[model samples]
Target: MMIHKIFPSRKHALHSWNFVMFRFAMLSLLFMMIAAGCSQVERRDDQYSISQEPQRIVPVEMPPSSDIDIAPSESTLSPKKEPETEFGIRLTRADRYSVNSILEKVLEYGITHVQLGGELITTVDDLILNPEKKAFVEAISRRNQSMGIHTYIWSSELNLEGRTFHFNWTAPLVVARQSAYRSVLQAVPEIDGVVLNFENAFLKPWEAVIPAGLPPFSSRERIRFVIDMVRSVVVDEMGKRLLVYAGTGKEEYATWLTEILENYPEEKITVITHASLQGNEFLDVWHPHFRTVGLHRHLLECDLTASAFGGMRFFNCLTDDLYEIWSQSRLHDVKGMIGLVEGEDFSRLATPLQMNLFSLAKMVFQPDIPPDMIWNESIQRVFGLFPASNEGQSLQALLRNSFFWWRRAGMVKGIPLLSYRGDLPEHADLIQPLKLIDSDALHPGIRFLLDELENPRKQTLIDLAQETLETTTWFNRAIRELEHIASSLNPSDYEWLKQRFEQQRLLANVYYYIKQCYWGFRYWEKNKSEEEALILEAHLQRLQQIGEHLEQQINSTDEIFYAKRIRDFVADIRGHFPRVILGWRDRQWNYLSDIRIKQAGPESVELSWTSEQPSISRVFATTGFPIFEITKSAVETPTLEHRVILDGLKRGARYIFKVQCSTEDGKVTNSGEYLFQTMPAPLL
Candidate 1:
């Protein structure tokens, strides 16, 4: 029966096979098309394509309201009501696709306000030339307004004709910028306000130093210009409500701010001031820029919320202290805080930014939220949970400890390091021994020349290296601990954890190289050893690789607030790397030795030390510690120390002491532990 059925020719069979193949291919094509359609459907939910028909731009002309309408509410700026906290974020770029995600985030965190970044527009050129940006601005404004989130345009000194107007108010560009701003306001009246980033130009690091034969720009003139702009645009034109970021300035500026507020009515203005908590003058000597009155004091004493202005809204700038800033702001009667985020990505934001925003929301609105719960949620979101184990817990602890130490290190020098651009002639004061060595720039936290330090024997360099070593150790330990936890995680989770910890590992690697670089350079300079030079060259190359890798990470992440700083750190490493130059001043290095306790008793003890090569007469001591034990903390000498006779000691108790010294050449010294046993008191 089979032979009879197969009597047809082979050609017939080939035709049948081709037909089947064609049908199968068609079916597969259809399935792929359907799958792609489904994928597009998902993206549609979160993205608004630019190709879609644009919204109608209806620019509003702000009309005068009746006195009753403008009248301040009885509550004024009080934050005790239903909307206790007004969370705002600064968006660096406004794109149509991001609108949905932003709105979703706004809904997620109850964000009440947003500051549209100035990067979108600078001069009249941007306004006239960039039509797409205009459309984008209008769309973003309308979208935000629809969601009941107020949006404001933010810009630093007006940029016009390629000239920046930050501190140079007298430039002709100021007048031109005023008209340009008006056009922008008319173009997007849906925007709630305009934040004038008016910081004193003279206060900026580059501007702070006056070059030879060039007089500094008149700060008074800059102030006058700011006042005029505020009066005209914010008060007279009434285009948008005024918001000002009066940065850390002197008492005169604060007084002037008070005077400026006297003229403007409340409810029409908000002042966002900088919070100096992390840079508290006592703890952070690195940040002399924040030496002025902090927001905590300004809010209370500046009379910003007084009845005269009908209680103006105040805000805190979380410059460094991420989560703690919210509580501090509320304590100071601040209505809300603006997360000073810098970066291009909001979706899947950087780990730090996500943590900061979540913490802010929890503190501001969800006070009952447990911190551990948040931590667990964050871990799950970033890296799916691994099975509970001792190693997992230990890894978590190590990661947390690493985070704390990293934050502490960054926070300690956040502001001062901010101002450290390249070692320009104007910034000679900041680079010690080469120029103005006695300047305040030589803070312990901001040792700019740490890696290139000339004196390897100097105790300051050793102490600095020790801190780097400790932090690096913590980072390394965290990376090792993560390995055990990784085994329990899925492939994706493991990869995510590795990527995150990669940052820490690289940081530790860089710090490790920093110490090596210092010692290598020191050896080369001391011995002119060809081997040491080669070592230094190799280390420098490796350091460069690590720095470039770190910079790439910084570039990839949308952690805007920290991106500049992280890059700056990389640049600093490069700058301090070994480079030969003529006339590089080698200041005499000073150190302390022969530290001896001349007298020891129950009631008092005499401590003495001599500077081998005197640089300064200062000496520092640590409080009583166990002999041969690591001192947890030490206090700087309140005044010069020749011989200190410490009084009121307890009898029959063992005490340990250590001494440190500073020099005019900006070098520091640390003497090892000096232990003494107090004799028992005589029978009274």
Candidate 2:
């Protein structure tokens, strides 16, 4: 009250006010210093944040360099490796009577590995045993370059009177046979091993009938005897390991192998058996360590057979059925063994030849390759015997003629398509008139061939075409006869028959036409005749349209129709596309995707998805423990969403996440595989 009255001057009053302000400022500064000190103390008590602050303001501890480890760079890490290569074979055999011709043909076809049958070598053996003929035997063996012995004894009939018992698996007969074969092997040092067909001993009635008093041997005993003989030859005399392979069936012989192998460690010997029996009841004891012998027919029957044969087949002039079987069994690791059989019934052989030729044609022409099963089955049906018929001779002639034509067609068409030997060997050219009228025609054999030919591979086209064409020709003849037979019968008796015949005819024709178009296109392309190639192209389009229509009608409810349609469409385009252009797309589409993840925090997660397509988006997660919700709020941009996802999750918990993205068309554009993690829980 007195200060206002007593204030001497304005200046003096202002100075007094300034002093009061200065004191208040000092007090505020002191309070701020105390609060900052308290904050530092609190931070120290928290432990987590104390060391994270700058040391200039407050003292902070540093972790040891060893305690704070850095991850190794990617360059320091090892890379994933590829599988190692496995040694495999491409085997052939010298058929009896055709040894020289067949061997030459095999060599012509670039076949190196071969098995020389006993009959083929018998003549040579006779010469070798006889001093005068010894040089001839040596010369023949050297000339032929026999890879291995075909078989020591094909039948137990060697025990018959006409033939002195050359070999028996059991008793003294076994020893005697081994000694004989051993001598043969020793004489012919180039020979690899023997191929025995124990089934021959039991297949025929003459072979099956046994003498009343002779000591009986069980199937097991026979197998043991065979094993013993093999051991004697391989282990005793050769001083080296040798293959012991035999032809067997799904019947008793397959069953007998188990007991035989059980007595001896299978690893000690290589045993080759038919794939037909691999999965039968005897499979439990089936030893896989040894080689598995798969005939062409068995190879074509089942995919599993490929596994048995280490992925290969014996490509010989076996029955169509056998060839079909081999084709069906896709033994990828095994190469084909191609050879001509001596004294083979061409009618029987013709089926496989035609089928193989057709397959080759198909391979050359079609964009979509077929599998071996279809070809195998087709060949089997074509070559397999029908019920005894009065038309047997004529049928045989027709089949032979058809086979010849098919072979010719294959040579003409396949050579150009495959760019194979432009010279067109005379042997292939000689068989042209028998070319199947329509390689696509459906018959029992064609159907089988088609089934086998459904999945084509690089090595399969030539053989598949040859098989398919042969099957188509045989099927065409069969369908024609059925049509005629139906025409002769009463309406009621033959109505179904006629319908069936028509249906089969349509299928057969479709197959044959397809083949023809394929080969024609191939031939035209090879000759650089654009117009002819275009004609064949148009023909193929027509056939495909028909096939597509039929397929759609038959498979109305098919879930895979779109896939099949796309496949066929691509195939059609590819069939017309030149090989040079085709290889480009093949390389482009072979890219693979890889994913990696890193953790940022116990509760927070980060992920990245990378690929050619940047538009991909979508993520799926599955955790052993319940997850509330995955949020995309962390990512600000849509395009970069694929880079990472911040998942707020529980600490110390395990989790898995899967991701996928869709195209605007609703098709799956991309997918991210499963990921696992757990968030860290905060400490007290």
Assess every candidate by TM-score: 0.54, 0.30
lDDT of each: 0.45, 0.36
Candidate 2 achieves a global lDDT of 0.36
Candidate 2: count the clashes: 87
Candidate 1 runs further than 4 Å off = 1-84, 94-100, 122-125, 158-177, 199-225, 248-268, 275-320, 343-350, 367-373, 380-399, 405-465, 487-490, 518-684
* Candidate 1: Cα lDDT at 428: 13
lDDT of 2 by residue, 1-684 (tens): 001111011111122545444533443343234323323222221111111111122222222222212222211111112112111122222222323333334332233334333332322223222333233233334443333222221212122111122234443434434444555455545343444444433222123334456766555665565556656655566653344443434334544654455566543454444334122112222224223332111111112112121111112122232333333333333223222222222332232333443443233223134333334444345534332443333333333233222222223222212111111112212224224334553234434433333333322333333333443444566557645544333454245333433443343344444444444544554466555445455555555666566666663222133225334643664556553311111101111134445677767677665433334465545443123245343233334235665656776544555444433443333231233435445557
Model 1 Cα displacement at 631 (Å)? 5.8
Q: How displaced is residue 584 in candidate 2, in Å? A: 68
